[model samples]
Target: MRWILLAISLLPHSLFAEVADVDLNEVSEQQNAMKINKCCEDNELMVDSVCRLVEQYNQSAWIPKFKTEDGKDTKVKHYRFINGIPRCETTQQRPIFDLGKSEDQLNMLSDGRLLHLIHHKHSTEDIKEDLSNNIYSIHENIALPEEREPASYIYEQDKYCMDKILLSNSNITGVYALICVPEVKINWRDTDFILKKILNPLFHAIAMVLFLLEAIIYFVLPTLRDLAGNIITTISVCLIVSQAADLVRIFTEFSNHVSFMITDIILYISLLGAFFWLNSFGFYIWKTFKSRNVFLRVTDVRKYCYYSAVVWSTVIMMAALAICAHFLLDTGTNPNRKMRSHFSSSIIDNDIEQETIGWLGIAIFFTPIAFTIIFNVFFYVTTLKVIKRINIYGRIHYKLKGCFDLFLQLSLIMTIAWLFLLLSWLNFDGLIYAHIVVNLLQAILVFYVCVVRQSHVTFLLRKSCCYAEPVPTGEWGDEMTHMNGGNY
Candidate 1:
């Protein structure tokens, strides 16, 4: 009677008790769970001690002294959600995977609770073991049982992690899986639904804005002269190409989620568009130089055979190669990323496709090196000749020549930066520093070309007016009247 009573009393608590998993029969599970629970119990008791250590650090909370993967005592901030769902403070971490926590924490985190089992700031073998075991549990079902895995999905995940990607205005070269939890079955929250709904509209609005701005600059802006008009037109074309690609990327993100492969193909078209953008700038510079120098005889250069046709042909070929390279590179391989078909490799095996594409990339990369060597020499020699002719002509304030010179300088700087990138490609560890330098170089060059051009125009206007009117005569009569548009 006493045994029956005791069993009845324990039944209520048992009903409310959380089990990590239904199958606790595995030898590792039974042993690991007991060991983990004991460790966690000890941690719970030492909350005050842990809190004291955590308070000393601002960036992360301190964990108890623990051994690391290398069997060395290491201090680190370990994150886990309590009860699976995250709290306001814990949700900020967005702990995607739990190295190893009971199933409750995983379900809670996925279900919009900030529940995680945190180990605080420390490394230990036990903790590592726990995390490893947890990850194993979560990922155990990755390869479906009794089902032949799709050929396309063979290396999908690996490629996704390896690829370089642009994400939400910032670039993310890789993502590391720190935790693994089973797919938790949970009800969706209002906030999640709201966020998902607004994402598409926001992207659409941005695309529309880009299109409108491109139109305003390209078709609506009034041009002072043919040269100015052409320059603006070239810039507008560049903007249009880039912005259109961005729009396509945004649309692809949403469409891919909805399972549209056609949209993915359309997205790939953006790569070609970007190449055109690069070519447009090259075209403008080449065109401007050709018209002013070779055709018009503005410069006293009649020695070397500088053919505009050859320069343009080379540029066209380079543009085509660049487009081909982007496709071959297939730098974006994330299956989980929006707009990417999870089974994109199914249509054509990614390895074979990538390898085929890579051949084109190699060709493109080498061609650019050759083109740079040949074209840069020609460009520089032409520049020197132009400068000499300008001095001989005694045109001190030659606005067109000044603008052309600025364009040439920027192009040369950009070309040098590209060369640096090529050299660094073999050692990707230096990519961050190289990227920053390239960005700074580009910004300064663009500012010098775009902003300084305006300054030059203003300076020339002042210089021309000074010669046109005897320094305004200091008294202001007919000269002042003319300056004021005859208002007086």
Candidate 2:
């Protein structure tokens, strides 16, 4: 009876306490709990119960970063998102297969499997082991299952299927696997190929022929053998040599490394020589207009010699510096050996090194060419001012006026062409086409302005074999007189 009374006492407190006034609203509030709402921003999405950036947002967030084997962060130049995961697409320093040789041998199946058809005589297991090892060496983060065996297929007819290893990895995308392959070859039917390779070379050839004809006229015609004509002829010669070297480089396959280097050096020297001579020509025009003497006299021959000395010496010095930079300042290793190896086997790393040397030479060469072009602009502007002054005073002859106009036109065309050329080198895509077109049209314009449109040239052409009537020299003499502050 005492035990039963103690149990009742223990249970009586809760049962007896609820008999007071009860609040229904408080009970209902406790039953219906307030829940917090989750929200995500525009670029964020709920991923795995957490707000995370979308794939595009992650991709656009600067360059991708990866942890190197040394535990340092290495920046990846390119990457892609696959299955909401970022995978690097950088070219491996040492690729397993020869990308150039394995062209079209690697393909991706619809089921996310890699199909590699190799002609190697190695066993399937060996090839798979080598591939797996190399892949892990390249990408440290990638994980492969030890028990995973790639599917194999045999092509009996071609014998190219001796090691037809099919790779299947959720982490391995087509881009990630074949990142070492070089960019696709320019399509034959593409506009860029047609314009750059086909039309460009053809136009260059035509321009070369036209320049040759113009050079012959300038040098051979007794009436056009003055100081001005000699300067023009020199410019033409430079262009001719440059164009010939470029054509050889384009069409001839140089098996010898030394031959290729020599050809490239010659091309650069001649190209830079052309611009230097153009700058000299502009200087001559400006000097002639600013002179106190009428006509380019016999004394100007001494000045011409000085100009030649300076221009040729400067060109030689530039060539020497370019050679030194290419050989000394480039890779410390033996360039000749590297170049030979590249030409023999076409190794991509060596090819890249060779291109680096080429670009270094170009940088050295173009620096002076750019300055010459700038100086040419200054000379042109000053010459135009002198001509305008002469025109206002009615001292410029009609034929001489026409000549100056054509000269300015040609100068402007060359300046614009070279500017575009510089832009093309800077990797401006649209400017490359414009650069080619401008340069191609330059030769045509030069021929038309200096030969077809020049009355003196026409007269000389017409009277080729016969004793011609004495050409009027008064227009030239009169222009010189006004430039020298004498009577027109």
RMSD in angstroms between candidate 1 and the native structure over all alpha carbons: 19.5
Q: Please state the error at residue 86 of candidate 2 in Å.
A: 41
Question: Per-residue lDDT tens digits of candidate 2, residues 212-296?
Answer: 9999987787656656677778877887787776555443222223255766788788878888877887777677678765455
| Per-prediction tally of clashes | 25, 0
lDDT of 2: 0.54
lDDT of 1 by residue, 145-260 (tens): 33332221111111111101112222211111212122222224543322323433343345445434433432332222233333433443443443344334332222312333
Candidates in order, TM-scores: namely 0.35, 0.53
Model 2 misplacement above 4 A: 1-193, 252-258, 295-301, 331-357, 391-403, 426-431, 465-488
Off by over 4 Å in 1: 1-221, 228-356, 365-373, 390-397, 420-427, 440-444, 456-488
Q: In order, what lDDT does every prediction score?
A: 0.34, 0.54
Angstrom error at residue 156, model 1: 18
Q: Candidate 1, residue 465: CA error in Å?
A: 21
Give the 10-residue window scoring lowest on summed lDDT in candidate 1: 156-165
